[model samples]
Target chain A: MANAVLTVRGIVRSFGAFRAVDEVNLDIIEGEIHALIGPNGAGKTTFFNLLTGSLPLTEGEIRLRGEVISGLPMDEIARRGIVRSYQISSIFPDFTALANVRFALQRKRGANFDFWRSERSLESLHGRALELLDELGLVEWADVRAGDLPYGRKRALEIATTLALDPQILLLDEPTSGMGREDIGRVVDLIRKVSKGRTVVMVEHNLSVVEGLCNNVTVLARGRVIASGSYKDVASNEKVVEAYLGAAHA
Target chain B: MAGTAFLKTTRTAGVSQSQFLGFTKARAIFFLLFAALIAVGPQFLYPIFLIKVYCFIIFACGYNLLLGYTGLMSFGHAAFFGMGAYLCGYAATQWGLPFELSVLAGTVIAAAMGLVFGWIAIRRTGLYFAMITLALAQMVYFIAMQAPFTGGENGIQSIPRGTVLGFIDLSSNTTLYWVISVIVLAAVAFYNRIIHSPFGQVLRAVRNNPERAKSLGYNVDRFKLAAFTISAAMAGFAASLKTITFGIATLTDVSYVISTEVVLINLVGGIGTIFGPVVGSFFILSLEHFLAPYGPWVLLIQGIVFTVFVLLFRQGIVGELQKRFRTHL
Candidate 1:
């Protein structure tokens, strides 16, 4: 059995009077695709924000491979292997798709500090950058400017850049959000393919994406964990349905 | 790959499979033409005027690194420019420091100041960031006004040019012009290297989407601060060069007025393009020199030019040219 790679213990984040995330706990087993599913306005993203250190934790701690990482800075957390993709497409729009992936590749090896050396000097990275791009089926879009890319290709490019870090744990926020049927299928397969060697904790609204790709599902509603199990278990959970449809409909 | 060869001729980061390494056949030709011009310019053009243009160009390019590449708008850039002048002038005039060491003192000190202010100012972003820089510059301006060594309102005057390497004579106007122009061209080349370096790529990424850069495991503020420090150091370098070339440091150079002038130069040229500051600095400085006889009407005419350019030619000279020609400038 795979061990827990990341453990969340009683994490809470509040905005003044409002509790955006409240005492949520989960164990992300190594190599398992874990889904954090919640309806709109639920704290799925806020929780992801806390986990990635994008937002400061109000209480409790998170352990990455058993070491406390809750108080680390965002980039420090990312460097320690918790890289995230934003819910909104967060690609460097002006850079070429190749450069976008190249940016992450350079950061991994701490070469972004090379101000005196020409970027061309890092030709050593091109093969690996192209390989990462090709991994996400982005090889053809490699030279295209990232902003000018179509929506589907742009999302793929973002994932390509994310994967360039070769992250130990990947946090994908709504990876297939706002996509058509065809694009969704491609992205789901892409996610499944990349999730082979590492744990993926994704905040997903699309239940089919969760069912087909995720092994463990944790349902969040009103900032609390309402359900935690396999997809089939969470789908029929009474509290989960009530949170989605409200009291009358459920 | 055969078809992509044509893209290699272009300068912009379009369709080209390789990174912009800041040089091409056209750029080589351009630099050669610049060298030829600087060599011959003193023969026909006013040497002082040419030297001033060079100084402003270097200053503007440095400012552009922060403003254009990093999207850091510092409205108080004159603090560095003026500080460079003040320190270089004092170091050379009183301390008997070599001209080169004096220049180093100016640039290094200004960069150190940049590190401190950037640490504080980067805590805020956008207009607030600009405001902090401006406030810091204002504090500098007041310090210059009250400081005894700076000579207050009268300013430091008649600073010795103190020969290159202590062996070369700089008293001759033509000799001084050649020396300043060469340094300016080298600085321009250095600026090009900076914008095309791996660090440059990361700065642009930070500009494009800082949060995304952070999510990619970069400490975003460090890049911003580093760019700020580089910009400040370069601004100081330009001012030190100017103080020696002109033989004076004054209140006007470090004042808020000069800060706005550098912005105008960048906006009028092309903010991010390779030679935008060069073209913009030449045009604005020439225009001011052209209108010098008009006395107080200089600001009014300059304002008109700025307004017309902003309205009709928003991309400035080089920016529009780069886009229209699909060429990297």
Candidate 2:
């Protein structure tokens, strides 16, 4: 097992009588692309929410580098270098693409409190921002309003916004949910490039892309992990086959 | 590290781009020239009228700071403005504090008032927030009406316009005008600084997508609170100056009507435009003075103007000019 950047142990989240996320334990190592896969309503996003501190854990300890971050506020968690991207693209729609990214970057740089100083002097922030745009192939649409962008581009921009936070661990919920084949390919490539040397935990449904990208895969069904292993191992397991592939195979 | 760096860089770019779009040297130049005009205008125009206009401009600018850039509509701004006026009026009259010190006291009090109101009201969003603030302000207005220091129905009258810097007698309308102009200029510059700074970007970000801003690591509540405080102080500063200039402060300063009037001025000028409030203040003040001869007809005309501005001219006068000029500034 590689060194875990984030560790979730005995985590359970519930609402009333329903257990949205049952006792779940997970570990994400540095520089690993860990794929979280499950059917709709399988508590995947709920788990993501808890991991990112958007929701409180009913019973668990979540640690970032051995520091407990179970119920910290979302912003505080984010400030500690853990951030998340939403399934629905949440961005500053009226702002230009670059502007949305810049907002996050400014937060990271502590340029926000100085009222008299012009932000233009933050050259390194700008230069690095443009470079990120270039990397995401958003250089052409840098000036476009985020709202005006196509769905795929908006998703890409959401990711770009998340990346600007310089998170040590990125929890992405449906990074390519509404993407076309061409966009999916481009996004997958960008994800690969962006996730280099950082831990990425994503909830991706596309099996092929999951297979191509994720080094480790965790599968959930009915609010509990049914199987978790290498794609080959999980795909070949009898329980996994009975739970997922058997329905299709039959 | 790559993903982290990528996210950080993208955020910076977005902020830099927004800063470039709305903030420019052209806007700065316009403000500088406008301040110069205000500074020297008492040489010709009636200093009393100019001071009144200056006060209104500050009120409009303060109100717009929340509504325009932060996208938060506050209906209770009159509470802060009135509170400042009453404080300045009471302090100068009763305590016999120095002129600038009294005004400063008013601003500090207003900021504290804003903090309390913001803490409670910000728990709600959109129209609910507006309503909550309005209710709170109405409570304040009633208190001001009944408070002993406020002189109840009559309000604090015959306020002393204490000498500026303990030397220059502000008894002269021209001297008072100069003092008001200097304060107004400083307030406008402060506004410009805040809206163009990185803090402004965060406000706009929260304005655009608060949930997104929170997930991206900003303490969104802090930004909102700070904005509320600064805005309240500016409004209070204006009111304080008005109290000193006019040598009186009354319930009129704290009324819902005054609140609506500030909004009207901003709406008539432009919401987001920096110099719009100054232009709007002058336009509306002149119209009011010119039509005073007609009594109630003046309000009727003002109502008609308000309706016209709301229905047909949403972008306002300066906004329209900026559009025509195709200049972002």
Per-model TM against the reference: 0.95, 0.89
**Stretches of candidate 1 exceeding 4 Å from the true structure:** B1-22
User: Where does candidate 1 chain A have its weakest 10-residue lDDT segment?
Assistant: A118-127
lDDT of each: 0.87, 0.83
Q: lDDT by residue for model 1 over A74-100, one digit each (tens)?
A: 999999999999888899998888788
Model 1: per-residue Cα lDDT over B1-329, one tens digit each: 32233333332333234332356555555667777888888788799999999999999999999999999999999999999899999999999888899999889978998898899999899999999999999999999999999999989999998889888888898888888987988888888888878889889999999999988889999999999999999889999999998889999988999899999999999888778898899899998998899998999989998998899988899888888877777
Residue pairs in steric clash, candidate 1?
none
Residue lDDT tens for model 2, A64-180: 999999889989999998889998989899888877777778888885766666655554565666666666667667768889998888888888888987788888889989989
Evaluated with lDDT, which candidate comes out highest?
A: 1
Fnat for each model? 0.63, 0.62
The sequence of per-residue lDDT tens digits that candidate 2 reaches over residues B90-124 is: 99989989898899988888999999999998888
Every model's Cα RMSD, please?
2.8, 4.0
Candidate 2: which stretches are off by over 4 Å?
Answer: A9-19, A58-61, A180-183, A237-250, B1-25, B32-45, B297-303
